[model samples]
Every structure is written in C-alpha cells, then in structure tokens.
Target: MPEANIADRFDLTNWKTESLRMTAFLSPGSPIPQQNWWEEICGSPPEVRSSQPRTGVQQDEGLFGDGNTQGRLILAVQPSRIDWLLTVEVVPTSFELPSVGSFSESANSFAQLMNRWLDVSPNLQRIAFGANLLLPFEDVEQAYQSLPAYFPLNKLDLKNAQDFNYRINRPRNVDYDISDLKINRLSTWSVMTFTAFQFTNVGSYTYSSAPLNVAIRLELDINTSIDFSGELSKDELPKMFAQLVEYAKEIALKGDIL
Candidate 1:
C-alpha cells in the first residue's frame, strides 16, 4: 500500500494526547482457591439456576464445560466459598490520526504496550503471556466516528483482560469473534472494538462484571476481608496518565508496522 495509506491506517498520534479517561478498580478480599478447595462439589450454585440461556447445553456444562479442556480448571475464591464477584474496568479513550494506516498501526502498538504492561503486573503475572491479549475497542460515543473513511478519530476504546472463560474452560481461545475491524486502504492500520463480562482471576483478586452493569464486582477471599474505605491515596492518576501518553508518543514516532 501507499505510504499515506500506511501512515493514516496505522498511526496513533491523537490518542497520545492528554484528554482520554482511564480508571482501575482494585479488590483485596477474595481468597485464592486451590485444588483442595473443591473437595465437595455439592452440585452447583444459585447463579447457575438463574443464568439466562436458550441453548441445549446444561448451565454447569456450559459454564464449566466438559472439564477436559486446557486451562478449564475450576476457580474458587476460597476453599469453600463462591459467593461474591469483584471486577476492575480500565477504560482508555484514544484518538486516531489522519492516516488510516497509521491509525491502525497505532492501535496495534497500543495493544502491544498493554500486553507488556500485563507482564509487569504482579497480580496478572501467573497467566500465560499473550493468552488473553488486550484489544482496541471504540467507545459508544465514537461509534459514528469509526467510519472507514473518517481516517482519524477523537477517541479509541480498549480493554485489559485476564483468565478468559472461553480459553480457561474451552481448551483454547482461537476465535476472533469481535466485529468492526477497520483496516485502512493498504491493510496496515486495523481497529476493532468489543466487550467481555465474567468473574475471573486478577492477581489475588476475583473480579466479575456484566456488560450491562455499571459497577464492576470485586471479590477477595483473603483471611481478612479487604477494606479500602478511604485507607488509600489517589493523587497519582495524572502522573500515571502522563507516563502512558509518553509511551504512546514513542510508539507513534517509531512508526513500525509489522
């Protein structure tokens, strides 16, 4: 493809600006469950009874699957507890640049940076590298601006994921089902948006969220229930955001689209 196509399609210049919103939720009470925790299955829980579905599969079977799938092992917040859900949602809004190719390339670069960040998070370290990789998502407000010819965008959406259920219980996660893949004229820049909801592992926390819900659920089964009722400080949000902005700037400047 032409250089203009490549640059517009893969560039991420606008997202590096300091206008997007990002947030993180931390849970500190759920206890990590080990193999010994499930000594007594006792059938299933109430959530299973009330879960909505129209397929032919049983609820437990659908949720837990056949049990032989790789990464499909059961997770108990505690040796004997499965009562609450904890979830953390980090929403980052990025802007695409003039070249669709560059925008797409920048989207990929942004995803890569998040992958590297996961590698450093002490809580997410145990999970396989690149197993449940992050993906760029467009915010609802940006749906209209995501048109193919728009070229650049005011904001791009994305998510950080962990212990994906389909991967954990279904042997492998080889499907790319999320729609809205915008590849520029030269096929260099590509952007996609989607959502995920489930109870899962994060560091020592067990978080849960529904695509339709507003507040993410967080669960910790630690010996002592975690309490953050004003025990923490939050004056560093700006500094952290500034650092991420620099990271994005560096990536856009490098202009590598492989």
Candidate 2:
C-alpha cells in the first residue's frame, strides 16, 4: 500500500482561530460616528451598544451577532486617536485537519466586507488586518527533535538551545511587508508570530510525561496603507492571504530537516 500523505499523518487535535480585525486610521480633524459605522457594516442596527468617557476622550462600541452565535462582529471608535476598528471571529465545533481552501473562502469574504467598509468611509487612511491560529500537537517531543532534520546546519541551528526562538525577514522580490517574524518554544508549547506579507511555518517541541500535553500556536498579522484610487484590488488580497496560509501549513506538515 502507498504511504499516507504528510498532512494525513500529522494528526491535528484541535484548531482555533481568532477574529479578523481591520483598523483604520483617521486624521485629527476627522471623526467617525460609532453608531452609524456599526449600523452600516452590520447591515442593520446593532443589538447591543455602549459608550464610556475616559479622561478627555469618548469611546463607543457595538456588537452584532449572526443569530446562531457562530461568530460576531464588533465596531469600536476612539475619539482620542480618531480610529475605527472592526473585529470578526469564528471557531469550529469539533476537531479537524486544516484546510487551505476553507480558509481562503473565509478570508475572501472578510476582504469583501473590508472593501465595503472602505467604500463608506473615505476619511479612513491606512488599514491593517490580521488573524491567529492555535494548533495542538500530540507528539510534542518528537516534533521538536524533527526540526533539525528539516532545517539542517547553516540553514538552521539547534545546537545550543532546547527551546527555539528567532526572527526572519523576507528576502528580496517578496510582495508583502513582514515585520518581526518570531518563533518561540517553551516547555509545553511553541508559538510563531509574523505579519501577513506572506506565511511561513515555525514551531517548537517539549517533552512531557503522561498526563501532560503540548501544542503550537500561530499568530499572523498584515497591515498596509490602502490606495483608494484602486491600486489594491479585492480579488488580489484574499489570494495572497490564502497562499501565505497554505504555505505555512505545508512547511509544518511536510518540511524535512535533512
């Protein structure tokens, strides 16, 4: 019989993702009406809302739910910085393997929503968007030991440390801007964080006796100044995001140390 594919053998135990966030900067003189923006983005009046005054600034926030509660949309306005922020997040009900196509579809829908928000608020300056992934590993120690095989000598160093932590900048010709790509390993789990210019995979492992568990968490973020004149197209954003996400998964599942 043929060997199972790398992805099939990984044995993913759990997958969780944080909400997507879009933050728009505003000029000093320009301010957005929190209620209006929430109503517009949510396509109806918000079911819950609140306002509070702190120091010399006012804060307004609204929450919108999709009925069944699978996800939620949040809008927040800060008077001091003149910023408008939107957040949306979703999680699966059961354990499942990662799927790039599903992520692509979700990202595409998010991009479309962001585009709509941009259309309504011309005062919006630069926009930043991001997401996070949490993954649990069963064979944490074996996974950590395998790293040297996938990234050997000159390319990767595993000699001096039991825990791994480092940052990598993108090489030339890369289209996105990634700031501070970091990977850190602890006794129980590993974490990787980077901006969305593109996605790369990094992880660490720890040995624990029975009754102990370990996992890896991946956090991704991307932000860019939007070009309202049409330089940034909706179609391109999701595709780029999809490619970045898919590549990270491939590296985690198939990368070889040798």
Candidate 3:
C-alpha cells in the first residue's frame, strides 16, 4: 500500500482525467432504453426529488441512494441510450480506520461483489448509458478500506452538500431549490449564486442526520425585497428544469448513482 497524501483530500485528479470521464455516444445497438423493462424485472429503486433553500432561493434536491435508501434514487439517462459521468477519487493506502477499526481486507471482496451484481443483475444496468463509480483516496491506498461495513451507504453520500466550507453552500440559503427558479433580473451582475451538496466522514460514526424520507419546502410571496421588473424568460426556466428532472429519473432507475 502507498502512503496517504494529506494535501489531496481525495485523489480525484487522476481518476477523472484518466478513467471517470468518458463520452458514450449513442449507437444503433446501444442498450439504453430498455432500462424500464430491466427495472420491472429486478425491482430496483426509483429516484425522488426534494427541495433545499439557500439565500431565499429554492432548488430541487436530486436523491441518490442505495437500494434501501430513505428517499428515492435519481438516475441519469438518454432516449436511445444512457450515459454516466463519474468523478471519484482513488483510495489512498495506509489509511486510518474509523472508530470501529480497519476493515482494509474487505475492500476487494466488496468490489467483486458489486461487479458480479452488475453483471448478473437484470435491473441494475438497464437504464444507464455507462456508470462512473469512483474509489475514494483512502480506499485505493489499502485494498479494502473497511468504511462501508461500518458506514453502510456512507460511501455513496455526496460530500459537497454536507460540508459548509465546500461549494455546496454556494447559494447560502437553507430553502433555495435551483431547479424551480431562475435569478434573471441582474443585468450587470457581479456575483452569481451557486448551490452544491457536500458530505464527509468526521471523528465519529457517520450517519444520515436527516432521514431518507425527508422534504423541505419554502414559500416566496412575490413581494419586493427584489424587483421582478426585469424581463423573465418564462420559458427557459422550465426547459432547463425538465432536462434536470429527466436526468434524475435515469440515474435512480439504473442503479448508476454509485
């Protein structure tokens, strides 16, 4: 095993440039649309939507989870075929174990199991174009980094939304859902709002602070702290939202969120 690089929180550079980023163009023989049939056969989970508020803005939250997720799963898909874009870091060797202890030896076993599941499972890959499963920096350091056994689905949790310092808090409001609204009034804008979801393991055992079955709603009265005097496109907002919704649908059904 190699030593851990504390400077690089997650070894994402090599994996993204080398293996995770790919373009799977649709082909006549691509198995993209049969995802629904596969889901019916295997009974994979479905994707669900929630709302998050930030800086008086509300954005939709796309849910991604393991089969037993508290919320629904979101998928990424295309019409004729589906595609996956994975950005994950390689595990580092000589990683420290969590509170429970080191389970390094179990890494290969889990990988093998997931691979077999994908190969034989009828419902898993049906809706995906291709999937991007990233290994954490710590996991790559040692063969089987015993994080999942103690953490269960913690590995799949997206780190951006959980960490406050991370980009996930770009919008900086608890009730803003990006999928539903567009901040189009600023003609000479200097600052743009960004919202991202982050997560990570801490000194203690990591668990879902919020349940899988969770929803947050926010109401905007259409009164003026800001003026709606600027022209609203009326069309572009929904168009972009529809695209996002569809992508979420594809990921949840295909089991590609990993």
Candidate 4:
C-alpha cells in the first residue's frame, strides 16, 4: 500500500453508515441445529430457508426482520464461524442510508444482540467487527477531485485515475486485558461512480437501471490476530466489542478531517 499523506480535509456532510456486523469463529466446530440457534436469538421458530452446497464454506443463512423496516438482520453460519449482519437490505431494493438517529439506534440494537449471543455461545477462536459507510458526492467530477484528500493519490492526475481503491491491513496492539494482544485492522475505501440497478424478486429476477451516482464508500474490519491460537472467553466479548468499536470509530472518523 502507498503511504497516505494528508493533503486537504474532505467534507463529511451527509455521510452515513451502510451497515454494521459482528462475527465470531469457533474452530473444530460442529453443526448445531439451525432451528435451535435461530430460536435462541429470535425466540421464535425458524422461518422458511434453503440448504447450501455440500462443500460450501459458509452455510445456513436466515434473515430476521419485518418488511416495514429499511433493513434486515442476517444470521449466517458456517461450520466454524457465525456472522450477524445488523442493518443491511436483504436484496437491496433501495439506495437509502440510515438516518443519524436510526444509525445510532441500530448500533445499540446490534450491541444488544451481540451480548445476547455471547451469553450462550462460547469457545471462540477469533472475533471480528466491521462497518460499511458511504459519503455521497454531488457529481462525478467533484468526486474525482476529492479522491486525493483522504487517499494517497495526490501525486497523480485524477483524469487517469479510474477504478481507484486504497486498502490496508496491519496489526495494532490493543490496550485490553489480554497481554500483548494484537488486533488486525483492515480498511478499504474508494471514490467511484456507481450505476444502480434494482433487482426485483428472487431466483429469477428483473432489473431496472437508475441514474448514475457517485460517492465515497468506506469499509473497516477490526478483528483479533490469527497469530494468537488461544480462544476468547464469552465474558471477554463485551469488552472486546467495546475496544473494537473504539478502534473503528478512530479510523472511520479520519475522513471527516485529514
């Protein structure tokens, strides 16, 4: 990755989070009853579902939500890992982002679910927390010019910079209870023009294209280091989540200024 040199502060008005997720991995895993696990979180019988390929990596996906909200809660599980996606559309029927109040409320709701899951699940090899956010631009030309502000493309001409992306993965020592515990901080951000196409229905789908849109898309993933072979106890999850959220906010807020 190229070094990031601060040039100018980018405008962060109208920015919003696209989604947030928390995941836990259990090595030497076993298949738990899908219905039992679903009922644990939802406190209701599992709804309609489908099975995955025999060799699939991540299997058993169940979506939780009513049709009235802007997003749905997704619980996807593989043999070794369980993922909880808090605020993302199932098929993405719209380009709407969560409002300020809603985003905060969503985060709080997600945390509640995370704590609930931790109460039952145990012996996790690793844990991860992530966020996806968007900061829209008025036009493509303006977006192209603003790329250099938060990205390391100040030396290059924006005219030639198409399909631009900047990503980095590094280890940071977290100030937590565990001794010498390092967390992997991964982030990817881009400024691009997007063409939206709405997908209707499932299996067989029809699409209709919308107007072109430009925005700065940001992704941040914070997780425990793979180097540590030890497992994280259930009691440690809430504190771990808090620490990860702090790190995520620190990185995500950088685009607001430098």
TM for every model, in the order presented, reads 0.19, 0.50, 0.21, 0.72
Tens-digit lDDT string for candidate 4 (27-67):
55545433345577777654444457574443333444433
The TM-score measured for candidate 2 stands at 0.50
lDDT score at residue 157, model 1, on the 0-100 scale: 26
Per-model CA lDDT versus the true structure: 0.25, 0.41, 0.23, 0.64
lDDT, candidate 1, equals 0.25
Which stretches of candidate 1 lie above 4 Å from their native place?
1-21, 29-233, 256-258
Candidate 2: tens digits of C-alpha lDDT, residues 125-194: 3344554444444545543543443232234433333545433322112254333222111111243321
lDDT per residue as tens, model 3, 187-224:
01011112222235656565333211111111111111
Clashes of each: 44, 6, 50, 0
Cα error of candidate 3 at position 194, Å: 11
Which sections of candidate 4 miss by over 4 Å?
1-13, 27-35, 51-69, 90-105, 151-160, 197-209, 255-258
The alpha-carbon deviation from the true structure for residue 166 of candidate 1, after best TM-score superposition, in angstroms, is 23
Using TM-score, rank the candidates from best to worst: 4, 2, 3, 1
Error of 2 at 219 (Å): 1.8
RMSD of each: 20.8, 11.4, 19.5, 5.7
* Tens digits of per-residue lDDT for model 1, 58-108: 222112222211111222232222221111112333222111122223334
